[model samples]
Target: MEKLAGMLKRSREDWAYCARDIMGVKLDSEQEKILLSVQHEKMTSVTSGTARGKDFVTAVSSLCFLYTTPRFKNGDLISNTKVALTAPTDRQVKDIMMPEIARIHRRMVSKGFGFMAGELQSYGIKTGHEEWFLTGFKADEHNHEAWSGFHAVNTMFAVTEASGVAETIYDAIEGNLQGNSRILLVFNFNRTTGYAAKSQSSSRWKKFRLNSMNAPNVLEKKTVIPGQVDYEWVNDKVSTWCTLIQESDFNEGEGDFRWEGSCYRPNDLFRIKVLGLGPKESADTLIPRYWIELANQRWQEFVKEGFPRHDVLRLGVDVAGMGRDSSCFCPRYADFVDTLKMVHSGGKANHTEIAGITKVTLNTHADKYTGKKAMAFVDTIGEGAAIVPILAEQGMTNVYSCKFSEAATDSGGNPLTDLTGQYEFANLRAYLFWAVRDWLDPSKGSKAMLPPDDDLLQEATEARWKFQSNGKIIIEPKDDIKKRLGRSPDRFDALANTFYPSSQEAVAQDLSGVFF
Candidate 1:
């Protein structure tokens, strides 16, 4: 107990020393710098790679901030001091940060630190007298109201996973900053335009960038403390990253292997998540921004006259399934394409409603192109499987079930081939996206038209593509794109399906089907 008191007295002068000697928390060199910066700087922003001990640093810093600040007049404990810890989600606050805080608090109590007294609860820690407390809350746009009423002269407000939190939530947290208070934001810099990214350039903020390669043991090649056993956790992390880089194919020929393999090709997912750098613009996006602008321009010119008549009209329908995503229907004839119409139900749209919409679109186009069988391509995944047969039963026999995961085949049931005469492409999803690229290619003499819709334009420009080892093209999956964009690109999916070849001759027959 005497030794604990002496250490506690010493900690009032040096927080980093206290953490290392008293708390037994080993911080790497980068983490040590960050800890010190948080203590001194008004705002500290840390962008780091995965598994870099960010949580551990945050936990120890909370304790140090509480222990070193001036105490209340009534007792030895720090008074009127509040530490607010928040994240993008409730699960992140309750499951990740709160546990780490509790663990550190328990360790301090076990070491006979008499000055520290707090009940370690699931939500937060409240020291004796309730004057000093560490609280956790979910900070997103929906829950911004919960961040109110925290006003303290000595306060440290910290946010974990700041990249995922919406800008409005960050603004709410910032509004509470008052005299002598500090703010800390830590995240794996994922997106190009978040509050976390914007803060990096602000003169008031001190920023730190760290990655697995710069881990404590990895950089020093030995333990910092004498008699400290080597765990090799840092070494394992570096090895895993190195293997992924070494094994990835660089067939895209423009960016690094990590960028090519990423779902957001040529973007900074690798630089931000693995190298701890700022976000970079995607170089090899599936659909260029200019292409979408040009397509919209072409549509404006084409719409001057009424819908042009053609021998065949194709309709592409993407069902809403459970209605979480909008159901989209796109109809096209030659160079003229109709604007996509998206519908939604409060919940899942009934099959009757899906089939009714599909039938109406098909019948209207079929009447326009009289004596011709207008083909309708319906996505046959999930609820779509039931919608296809319902459309056929409604006398729309020309409807074809387009399974995105199925093997790419021509209209004649022959395997589809790329320009290189080798079967390349993991599935039909890739084939459809490539077809969209070809349709928009000005060099091909195919003047395509599209609606002037910003949502569709954004979706088209953000889609990414990669080439396989055998030189086959692959499109980023919708689920992966949804993670980055927060919603599925349903309109773009329907548009791509419209570009499916109507004749077997459109795709080569001599190439062999090589699945990778």
Candidate 2:
């Protein structure tokens, strides 16, 4: 009781908590101090991005046990007492708040007071809808250098052979209201990387197979085309990612952390900080920024291609209504066409029209496309059936309504499915997964895809696959996609489905006068 009273006294005086004892177990003063310091550091100085404090805290927490290491034969009175008081919660210390404890000791040696501020800023109170706000604290970035170094080590170790080190290093890196909620982050972080090596080694990565057990919060949005392991989530906004690009030595004069626009300035350690967390509602605010940047970059790249050199062309349209999702038009057979255009369905009608015009402008060689050009329309899309018929009326003989396979079968008696056929689900899904793998793991880039703005490619990346015990796979959509990803990955899936086997066969078929 005395130890508890003493700890509470210190916690209240030093950490400025409204109350010390919460529920029953004594609130840790040491943990509070470290958390405060971290919070202080974050809002004031830059310390190793936003994840270093957790790393430091965990390291210190592990060392806390050293004080109880049977110092005396019977154990010193004070040491024994400390251990006796804390041992009951030993599991919590080692597993739950290890990082918080580590931050304290690290601060003591580093003489950094900013740690407290950083912790406070990071300490969040959740309102409904997965929204969070820093309670009685402001965001800061004090120990940028130290924090950056910490993140670098943590992220690097996480992706490399030192993943275990990362687990222990950043055990307290979450802002969940309860340990259970926070532990989910840890579990996902660890499990998500189980086959990371395989995913990264390939130039093209298949969607990772995930179950509700592996990720309960995640909602399945859709599956990849075919023959791949890619999946999409419709709504699972509660997620975060932190990575360390490199380590730096402050002796070289580079600070630990620096953010220039969305890109973090490369420190001597080459720290690359990437993190995403917030409510589904707020996703709208940030997603557009990423998309705009991505789309513009893609557009610029497309413009540089000058124009297509192909004399004969094959064009396609997969349109969408201007809802939350953007509408898009993709022109494949172009001379200058590279896989740089950020095309999708569900944007503005203007963008759709613009994309169509851009595709034609970029690919349609005036001299070559005079009479040899060809195009197709999948009537299922928005304005697709209507637009194609109108175009056909205007003498565009290439327009035709899409049809599901009436008589198609694979070698082994498998129904050549309309959903899976035209898209070449097997190869297309595999290719898109490989693209994700290349993005996740660049070193082992063996199975890569050619650069093309295929909706199927994007959809494949968003597709979610589940590998059964027998190795069979399934793809489907989830209701709560907003929680899984900031937005619906349906667009990406739709694009991936474009390359299904049936679609490939359809494309290969000569349509000289089919519409007529």
Q: Which candidate wins on TM-score?
A: 1
Candidate 1 RMSD to the correct structure = 16.8
Clashes of each: 0, 114
lDDT of 1 by residue, 1-516 (tens): 797668778887777887877666777778899899888888998888766667767878877886676476655554578888888889999998988787777777776654564678888877775657888888868766677767776788888988888888878877888866778888887875667875654445887777754665445667653322233653443344333334334322222333224322334454565556655446667765456656777899878876566757788888886646578888777677777788885558677887888787777767564677677777778777888667656555667767788777766677666544564666888888877876775545548888777667667766788887867677877888888666778878888777665552233222212100
TM-score of 1: 0.48
Q: What C-alpha root-mean-square deviation, in Å, does candidate 2 show against the real structure?
A: 19.9
Q: What local distance difference test score does each model get?
A: 0.70, 0.30
lDDT of candidate 2 over 1-516, digit per residue (tens): 796447544543433231222111122333334434322322111112122233333233222222111123342222111110011123433443433443443443354323221232122212221111112111112322322222210111111111222322233222111211111011112222322212211223221112221221211233322211122221111112222234332111111232222212232122222121111112112121122223334546655766444443333444555554544343344222234233444454443363355335434543464555445434234445445444544555444444222223343435333223332223233433322322222123212222433233333333354444543333333333334444544444333323333343344345535543
RMSD of each: 16.8, 19.9
TM-score on alpha carbons, each prediction: 0.48, 0.34
